[model samples]
Target: MKRYRFEDLPDIIGELLLKMNSIEKLLLENKVNNVVADDDLLTISEAAKLLKLSVATIYTKVCRNEIPANKQGKRLYFYRGELLNWIKSGRIKTITEIQLETETKFNSKNIYK
Candidate 1:
């Protein structure tokens, strides 16, 4: 092992602290990135961007209970999965599906005759 003079060790100590501080910063950033990449809840602006709607409109929907979301304290939170599911729930039936349903209804009426 190499030994440093007592006075020289102070400089080494400062450098070590700076390096440790930098490493800690990097670790914190990585943790934040991981949380953001996961299926975490999103803010109103984030939900707006994901849904391609105006923030005002989002607020309105939340007010009238037209959108699926939660209010924690005074802030709103949305799950990306639930937003996608809400979009899916608004899907309109295809022409073929409408036609099939009509036929089934008519056939059922005939059977009852």
Candidate 2:
């Protein structure tokens, strides 16, 4: 290790403090990410509330295999992320989006022809 002069001690300490602060921030961020990634499973009623549907409707969807779910014996569970994705999959395209898609398809076909 290189010898440090008295004048360099303060600078060295400040650098060390900055590194520690950055490491702490990184650790905290990782913990938050882990918590979000390991979200709790939702029961049928809770899933219904999240989806703004009735419990009966949730059960019907599960029976029809229209929604993603898990079953443990008689208990039903849903992943929040999967439920959110299921909602997203039913998204209706806006008029502008439909027009853009039509234009792209027409142009591509014309190019091939």
Candidate 3:
């Protein structure tokens, strides 16, 4: 590290502040982008791509009301959060999880007896 004299301190501090401001701007932009992405409205094709399913399947699911979506006139839109939640809702419990749940239920029943 180069030792800075008192004269150079002001310049060094100014440069640091400029760099910090640039970094702050970049961070804020990134956060805004992430927020927008989370709430983004996705078309049928985009939803299909995100869910790794065919567009036709997405349409069928929408028709059956199995997937969360919004219909605006002739257009169908899905929220990224809703799609992610739908995926999460369909998750199958593991055997261990089921066993633990069963055990908890049985124990609670015994306690109530």
Candidate number with greatest TM-score: 3
Pairs that collide in candidate 1 are none
How do the residues 1-113 of candidate 3 rate in per-residue lDDT, one tens digit apiece? 88889999889999999999999999999999988888999999999999999999999998999999999999999999889989999999999999999998999889566
Instruction: Give the per-residue lDDT of model 2 (tens digit) for 1-113.
Output: 89999999999999999999999999999999867854769999999999999999999999999999999999999988888889999999999999999998999889567
How close is every model to the real structure, measured as TM-score? 0.60, 0.67, 0.69
lDDT of 2: 0.92
Ranking by lDDT: 3, 2, 1
Each prediction's Cα lDDT score?
A: 0.92, 0.92, 0.94
On a 0 to 100 scale, what is the lDDT of residue 63 in model 1? 92
Ranked by TM-score, top first: 3, 2, 1
How many times do residue backbones clash in model 1?
Answer: 0
Q: List per-candidate RMSD values in Å.
A: 15.3, 6.7, 4.7
The list of candidate 1 runs beyond 4 A from truth reads 1-39
Q: Compare candidates 1 and 2 on TM-score and give the better one.
A: 2
Q: Which segments of model 2 are wrong by more than 4 Å?
A: 1-31, 34-38
What is the lDDT, from 0 to 100, of the residue 91 in candidate 3? 93
Model 1 per-residue lDDT tens digits across residues 26-77: 9999988866655569999999999999999999999999999989999999
**Candidate 1's error at 21, in angstroms?**
42
